[model samples]
Target: MLSDTDLQAIGLTLRLATTTTLILFVVGTPIAWWLARTRSRWKGPIGAVVALPLVLPPTVLGFYLLVAMGPNGPVGQLTQSLGIGLLPFTFWGLVVASVFYSFPFMVQPVQNAFEAMGERPLEAAATLRASPLDRFFTVAVPLSLPGFATAGILTFAHTVGEFGVVLMIGGNIPGVTRVASVQIYDYVEALEYGNAHRLAAVLLVFSFLVLLALYSWRPDLRKT
Candidate 1:
């Protein structure tokens, strides 16, 4: 049976994932839109930066983020100047780290969806004198619902499974930053294999169910 601390970890993990996915939905959409539609010279560079986490080791990214958000770092200085204090080892810190770590997961699918949409719909909307924003809200977004769903599901799941980045940025503070994965780690470290197995099984079953539903619900929407 899972203890109260274990339950807290699970709840915290869900909250973090939910918040991260929501942020990604809002922030990533415009980026994906630009990536799919623009022919700007800076596109390649920006895209590469967004995709960096896909290849960069989690610890490496977390290390740099920690440095950047440390007291001596510019981000830390700026936050302090603004009276926001440091970000590391807090729930919001986990949010910031998770956002970066899971960004590409959200953006890539939406970008692909927009690309697959082709130019015809946008062109048609323009022919009707629809402004860019209006057309995006009306035509492009409505048509790309599947893409958004894919992005949301993937981002949520990815954030839930995150360990290294969250551990580095948020530490193992219970209720504050001890998410499900971190909770599982603590169980194993304490030789509490029963607890570890229980927690791990929950995560495993969840991941499997999420993927199964995502894949089976709409096979034609996005390829796995």
Candidate 2:
């Protein structure tokens, strides 16, 4: 039996995950493509930066982001200059943090997919007089569907499970920033074990299902 607050937290979690996944797809695709194809010396550094969150503590990342979005911080000053106010403690702030936290989950799989593609298909497309952009759209993306699916699933699931980062920046504001993980934390802190268990169980089952679907999916073998 979920309380109204718990239900709201679930809904907010879904919304946050959905938003973060979509943003990651748009932002990570070109970055992954470049990482897969670039031979530049900067590739290693860029890739390392992209993968930093995987190794860095969430609290550390969240701390920096919190400062960066604070009223006097650079990001905060810039946004204020642009009249958008401070980002921390807002939905958009959560979206930005989630995107950073889940970035590697989205990029790595797609980058691997691109690397596995080899040069043969692109060369074939070249021979057909297909422009670089055309080949990327018509050839590269179609073949990379599996990677995209994996990236999207991983990003969404990771975002849904986020806690430390969201907590550090989002500040538990009910429908605004009180996500399921944070709500569960509050429940436990208040000795409300039943509520905590209910939410935790839902998240556990949801995450398992998402991963199961990702593993079972066979994009290459599917009849399109």
Candidate 3:
């Protein structure tokens, strides 16, 4: 019953969420590992930066990012010089914004998993003459599968539901940046409650399923 526009929005949202989750996994891993194992004084500061999005308003964060990626900002200048053009109002812009906005959701769960694992597994792996990288990939990662799942689910869901950040960065260009959330907003603003309801209901069911999967498989991911 959904229109093509609605379907495109949903598909784009999935694409953005998927891209954001993957980037978070790659970027958040080292950060979480360091947070879990490091005794450095910088840990607190770095962790605070990672967790800042949780407390900051999405619009505020997005505004800063927009400014940074705008023509006058350094990011824009660098991108322009590199021929990458401006990032704002683009699909990749949404991905970048989603990554920053959903960072804490990914980090906290994975960091908790890594910390819960302790150093015992890595130490044991080392005793077997495994290299540090090998120990992490073979021992640490395998033991933290639940946490990775938790992080991925949370990140994907959060990105899908994002509004202010995506709106600021990507605008409402259909098939480009008009994701489900923005589409729903457009429906409401135009007094199209029926369409809004349909989209909202879809997201509602999806979110419920994601949470159900998370809790059913790893309730402790919810605890921390």
lDDT of 2 by residue, 1-224 (tens): 88899999999999999999999999999999999999999999999999999999999999999999999799999989999999999999999999999999999999998999989999999999999999999999998888899899999999999999999999899999999999999989999899899999999999999988987775543435
Q: If scored against the real structure, what TM-score would every candidate get?
A: 0.96, 0.97, 0.96
Alpha-carbon deviation at 21 in model 1, angstroms? 0.4
Better of 1 and 2 by TM-score: 2
Which residue pairs in candidate 3 collide? none
Q: By the lDDT metric, which is better: model 1 or model 3?
A: 1
- List, residue by residue over 1-224, the lDDT tens digit for candidate 3: 89999999999999999999999999998989989999999999999999999999999998999999999988889999999999998998888889899999999999999999988888999999999999999999988988899999999999999999987888789899999999999999999999999999999999999999888978664354
After superposing candidate 1, which stretches have Cα over 4 Å from the reference? Answer: 220-224
Best by lDDT: 2
Winning model by TM-score: 2
Q: How much does candidate 3 score in TM-score?
A: 0.96
Candidate 2, residue 103: Cα displacement in angstroms equals: 0.7
TM-score of 1: 0.96
